[model samples]
Target: MDKYKQSLSTSTRPFSQPFCRRLMKPRINYKNISLISRFISQRGKILSRRVNKFTLKQQQLITIAIKQARILSLLPFIKFDII
Candidate 1:
């Protein structure tokens, strides 16, 4: 392989330049069920930062929001087994 091609193949990380489009932040309100669900797993668990790519503050907000939704019966505490 040519020297230039070898360098291109080894670069996996995206450029540090700010994205043209920003990622949408999730709402902390209980009524924002749609957005909240995207940050949670099908098993009714909150997803981690690595998977969700949310900032520390955002993750904390999501955790509290999901808990509130659960308490209000807006979201499930645990998903029921189909089997």
Candidate 2:
């Protein structure tokens, strides 16, 4: 199907998401819970690189930071919704 072909083409392409050309790299800190929350799901799950569009290194850093934040009580391990 057209969708499947398009997905394959994109996967082969370099840099699926926009890459920063800056000399300095962005810092991933556990203390920045607000920013880290963007990479987490509503159920307190860390999103994958495919969904977040982050490079492998960045994704690893995010996962580590999220785990650290959770241990420190900055981020929650599980989210409970009030229905």
For each candidate in turn, the TM-score is: 0.65, 0.73
Q: After superposition, how far is residue 9 of candidate 2 from its true place, in Å?
A: 9.8
Q: In candidate 2, which residue ranges exceed 4 Å CA deviation?
A: 1-15, 18-26
> For model 1, where is the 10-residue window of minimal lDDT?
15-24
Q: How close is candidate 1 to the true structure, as a TM-score?
A: 0.65
- Tens digits of per-residue lDDT, candidate 1, 1-83, equal 69889999885753332212234343366789987888889898999876776566667777988999999999999987798
lDDT of 1: 0.75
What is the lDDT of every predicted structure here?
0.75, 0.80
Q: Could you tell me the lDDT of residue 35 within candidate 1? A: 79
Q: Write the per-residue lDDT of candidate 2 for residues 1-83, one digit (tens) a residue.
A: 99998898786646464445252145578987777899899998999888877788777888999999999999889999999
Q: Which 10 successive residues of model 2 have the least lDDT summed? A: 17-26
Clashing pairs in 2: none
